[model samples]
Target: DARVTQTPRHKVTEMGQEVTMRCQPILGHNTVFWYRQTMMQGLELLAYFRNRAPLDDSGMPKDRFSAEMPDATLATLKIQPSEPRDSAVYFCASGLVRSAQREETQYFGPGTRLLVL
Candidate 1:
């Protein structure tokens, strides 16, 4: 039984605290995706990677958001100096899609819910 797992399902932090979210995608999956869901952004994709190589992260706020894969079994998303506007649900998903040229469905984790004051 394989599944995506996320840590800190809920978090509350001050206006300038650093927050880190973790994700464990299903085994054998080679692509990972990060998305942020907010009232204003709806479901906007933040970043994407294939085989640990970033494919596109144009949707992410480059100033404070960073995403990476330390290994095949681990992926992380970090936010520094989190702002109130950053309050939202962050999700990590993994898939077999190697590129946009292929249409592999992504499976989402439970998501990390963050609130900034």
Candidate 2:
């Protein structure tokens, strides 16, 4: 069975610290997505990659956050000088891209919950 995995399921960090979240996408999945959720924003797509290449990250703060796929199976998100406002649950999802005529469903991993004090 295909399943997405995330590490360091929970984290607590001081303001200005760096936080890193990792994910392992299901094998053979060509699309990977990173998302952030908070009470204010509900859920937002921070970034997504297709075929291991980043396609969009405009939703994320450019100077403080980054998302990348180092290989087919691994994806990572990092925040430098993390602030209390950045504390939220981050999720990684994987899906198989289908043609325009078909629909694709993404499977999300159990999110990494972060708390910045």
TM-score of each: 0.93, 0.95
> Tens digits of per-residue lDDT for model 1 on 31-111?
999999988768999998889889999998999999999998898999997999999999999988655566778999999
Screening candidate 2 with a backbone cut-off below 3 angstroms (N, C-alpha, C), the clashing residue pairs are none
Candidate 1 runs further than 4 Å off: 98-101
The best candidate in terms of lDDT: 2
Model 1, TM vs. native: 0.93
Q: How accurate is candidate 1 locally (lDDT)?
A: 0.91
Query: What's the lDDT for residue 93 in model 2?
Result: 96
Per residue, candidate 2 scores C-alpha lDDT tens digits across 1-117 of 779999889999999999999999999899999999999999999999999999999999999999989999899999998999998999999999967747888999999999999
lDDT, residue 83, candidate 2: 98
Q: lDDT values of the candidates?
A: 0.91, 0.94
